[model samples]
Target: MPSIRCCSSFALAAALAAPGLAAACSTCGCSLNSDWSSQGYATSLGWHLSLREDYFNQSQLRSGADSVSRSSFAYPADEEVQRKTINRNTLLGADYSFSRYWGLSLQLPYMDRHHQTIAEGDTGVSTSDARGIGDLRVLARYQGFSDDAGIGLQFGLKLPTGRFKQDFVSGPQAGELLDRGLQLGTGTTDALLGVYKFGYLTDSIGYFGQAMAQIALDAREHFRPGNSLNLNLGLRYLDAGRFTPQIQLNLHGEQRESGAQADRPNSGAVLAYLSPGIGVRITRRLDAFAFVQLPVYQHVNGLQLEPRRLWSLGLQYRL
Candidate 1:
């Protein structure tokens, strides 16, 4: 028979794990994928704030890792130049739950980017750097499902708050404009819809699944980004002392960008990642989490730079 303290600890673990923990995704583009972050944690009326950072460095032009079979254009053997990019992001997000049934979340991010394009014949590299605030996202959530399980719907808007037309200031392309896709923001308003579900597989383990769709409501500067969808499925262990271990499978797909300024050939892809993470409960109202997403499968429409791996780290506090 289990002791009373052990039983109580189990109950506490279950109670804490029943609600979704809050954490941001690393690959939602400029939009906020906050649906999974609010689950299992916002069961009551409370305010939550989180600070997260993620990094990605893309130096290789891959058509799925060294194979250019799917690319529409092939590089000549003499062509020695391609593109490389390094992106860093810092995000601050806040959430307020009016009750167990209603909540709102807002996120703002600062983006730092460095892009380099090598010349075809020369070994010279041209570099352009841009740093500024990115887009903003606001989401309203409604959780009208049974208390024992979690199911919810989210509707939101993405505001264009960053710079879309960034010019190369000190490179070979100086005075020339960068690709619209490489800009800090889309300069278009977007609509977001999402669904999430959370439940227990057993007494000591839990699972969550979420899907989100983002579409541009309007175009800007004759450029319109493509529609995107993100799906995540994860499992977590509840009774692991102060450390919760989790694994997630994430699938992200996008339609190609369209417009006169769009680079359709290098715009869209469907990628699958295996993300493993750990959650630490620092206190009753504070928590920390980190995740690393590794690409298991990738299919790009054209030649593009894709990161070998991505990582996210964050801290959350409830008030």
Candidate 2:
């Protein structure tokens, strides 16, 4: 039998804060179970490292669960017109288990994002690209609830280690500071808490469930991201020997942005996705996985850009 650890991706913060310059859904992330997201969790107690890369493009305009045209947000008539947003995110994680009861994990994020938008009066498209480290998270886990450590709790802190003062370098918005939601970091410390449980329904069927919350501690320069929450459920076919086939349902919700610089009319959202993935063990110490996410339901507070699909690939090695 394989051990299904309760590990998840982190980005759980607030949405954009600006005069409608940034993107929406700060809660949008890879959302992978990712103990490596693969099968290399190493049931033993030791150090492990994992890396995963994800890509998504938000070119579709949506409002209140309905698709809208870009012309609906034209200049003068509206304060903003969004063009497109693209993201390629990479995550590095390290985990160490002290015993069956306790463990520690650290995660770091790097982002390559491009945004294009037009202000209310500006006719030209203003573009900006941000590439750098986003944030760092440190967490502790306790899985001593059962003899097999199938139930666990996770608590952590999101550090403000990334740059939030980047500026657009092209078009009419050149030299203007990038919106809070598009920057490399949120610029605010956040608290994270979550719980998870994993077990087997039968000898070949395994199931897991998790819920997490991320709340901002304070605002920075009159801008703050909203609080976010996530819920996940998954099942894996364990009969495949070296290969594990999996399916998951993920739910994400975020509050509206707050602060004078923030506009609530175009931010927060509630999104649900269906994710299916497969994992393969290449060696005893190495594993790989791939997954794709498609939105089953999406409702936003206001005008926002959302991806039609998201995909990711990952690798993990036990050291």
Candidate 3:
């Protein structure tokens, strides 16, 4: 039987922060599980490495789960517009165990993104593309509960390593600075806090729950990303030998951005996704996993482009 583990982090933190800040659309964040911490095979003092890739294409504009096909302009009196976006992320993560009760983790990501918009008033298409490294995250974790009923606490920081003020090299919006949300990074330092718990049921099934919070501590370029909260509830069936099937419910909510460059009207949202995944134990020291997230419900604040679906694939190896 496969071992049940509790591991999750902000693999998509940069993606979710981009909507309205940089692009005319919103992108889904891919929260990946960190299995090395809980699996019995990784109880010894050592280090673990992981590689993850996430993909999503968001093109449709919506308001509260309802599509917004066309909107009449109040000022122009005869204009309508449409927007779309695509984003991809590749992440490298590392975790080290200092003792049974303590550990540390870091994540670095690279991103490629495209944005496009068409308006009735303008015949030309407005498009932009950006590719580079995203932000960086470092976290410290403490496992303070019993072996059976485990509880973990995490605290971390997000560094502004990704480019924030990218300009359109060529396009209808050429030489113009992209939206702060559309940049590779927020150019802000953020504080991350999280708590998680896991346990088994009937020796064959297991369950876990986690909650994470992100708050921007400082801003750059007259812009600041919004504060956000994330919640995840998951069930793992461990009786399937080397193959483990899992299901997760993920919920995310964010407050609107604040500052001079903020896009208040098109910011903020509450989104819930149903994620189905499977894990394969390739060896005692390596594992592979994949997951797909489908939006079950969404209540966006304004007319913003939202993701139709999100997918991720990853590998973890003990080092």
Candidate 4:
């Protein structure tokens, strides 16, 4: 028989392993195919504030049915399922130029997420909202090589701070939602390594790209934070002397695996979108911009998350 402390540890590990099971066990995991930061270097203060609105129409699942399989307390019959989510985020930080060989960067972000599900013919709907500061990241960039044409190198980091608890809806999956949203930290540390490069195609045109992979340490049991990979590609139109107006597109994806021997699921998720954005130079020390993200494709564990589409408007200032 296991000791009391050992039993408690086992129980805790099982509980922690549940969330990833949903992603890992089914086709839904296919959606977790890439990392989240595939946008290259196109944000504002070098700071950026983005407000996004997302709408999703989920597939209907069967509820309680009547005798003879007639019509009873079924879910909304309408095929149109709707959910609205709002996210407001601010990234404040800067990149330092430490000669042509080394550099450093720091960033902190504040996030607020609100979700609502609306069903046809139903007067009462369900809602969940959370607001708080999210994780903080510190990074160092090395300028391994550069010419008048472009610069390239590797980067790495530390992520601290976790989100806080917030209200959740009541339902069968309420616990899952609450756990995903309010569990604060993953109770683990993450390390990432990435390569970035930027250069000009011409005096008036520029391009950038980056790739990164991360591994988790001290992860919760059954919830092995799988290795993640991200890629970014973008093009910009530079002003001869002033700030430039940039119209660019970004792509991102991620994958997560369950811990070994854990009865949990393992899976992947991928999100790919195109964003048209614009940036303006306000002064020698300031710039601002806005963009919209439209999901061209998204697959979660082999199932579709409805129509994966979102709109984002943002602004940034640099000093």
lDDT accuracy of residue 33 in candidate 4: 13
What lDDT does the true structure give each of the candidates? 0.64, 0.71, 0.69, 0.39
- Per-residue CA lDDT of model 1 for 99-135, tens digit only, reads 7778888878888888776434444556778799978
lDDT string for model 3 (1-319, tens) is 1233323221111111222242345443454444444332234567888898889888768876687764544423233243677878888888888877788878888988887765335555667788999888888777757663267777888889989888766546677777777788888999988887666666777767778788999878788888887777777777677787888887888877777887666667888888888888787667888889898887776667777888888888877
lDDT (tens digit, per residue) of candidate 2 on 264-293? 678788888899888777776777888898
Which prediction has the highest lDDT against the true structure? Answer: 2
How do all models score by TM-score? 0.84, 0.90, 0.87, 0.64
Candidate 3 C-alpha error for residue 106, in Å: 0.3
Error in Å for residue 78 of model 1: 10
Which candidate number would show the highest TM-score if scored against the true structure? 2
- CA lDDT of 288 in candidate 1? 77
lDDT of 4 by residue, 120-221 (tens): 344344566666555555555554454431344445543647543444564323433332322333334567667665555775665556665555655553
